[model samples]
Target: MAKILVVDDELGIRVSLWRALEFSGHKVTLAKDGEEGDRLFRENPTDLVITDLVMPKKEGLEFMSGLLVDFPDLKILVISGGGVKASSKDIELLLDTAQTRGAVKTFAKPFELHEILACVRDLLAADAD
Candidate 1:
């Protein structure tokens, strides 16, 4: 199993993802924002990171850029529900930027849990090879 870091500001999302990932046999860590996520990543260096796009204290694009600079091989999955008023185009732009920066996969909020787990498995498996 891979060590995974999940960064999001929502408590409910964090808890649900934590439960699912843990149940899948992966070691999981939670961060409330990009700053905390970066700190935890620097300290622990997990195999994969799943981060939310819209967050306080750094945001996903900036965080992913930093990670790519420091760890080019790092695996990242970017997710977002966007803001209350954000349009689909806005979300697409944000996720596109994340992909350009280095995220391996992107998911809009309310995504299938199994899909995320499958992505995690694929990324870790690729790294293992």
Candidate 2:
């Protein structure tokens, strides 16, 4: 089983991702914000990291940069809940930027849990090979 870290400012999101990772037979760790995420990451490296793009304290981009510096080959998935009324263009831009920053997959807010799980599975599987 792979070790996975879930990072999000929202408690609900962190729980949901944790459950999904557990159900998928992976070991999961939870971090409430980017700063905490970075701390945990430095302490114990995980096989993968799933983080929210927008958050309190340090943001996802900052976390990504730090991870790459410390763990160049670390795999990541980024999620963002841009807005209930955000323009499609803005959301696209955010996603594109995340992809450029080491995220193998980017999911928008209100996304299906299954979709996120699928991405996680795919990324982990790819890394295993």
Q: In order, how many clashes per candidate?
A: 0, 0
Residue-level lDDT for 114 in candidate 1: 91
Which lDDT tens digits does candidate 1 get at residues 1-129?
A: 889999999999899999999999999999999999999999999999999989999888888889889999888998898867889899888888888888999999878999998888888888888
Q: Return the lDDT, model 1, position 23.
A: 98
TM-score of each: 0.96, 0.93
RMSD of each: 0.8, 1.4
The lDDT per prediction is 0.91, 0.87
- Measured with C-alpha atoms, the lDDT of residue 32 in candidate 1 is 93
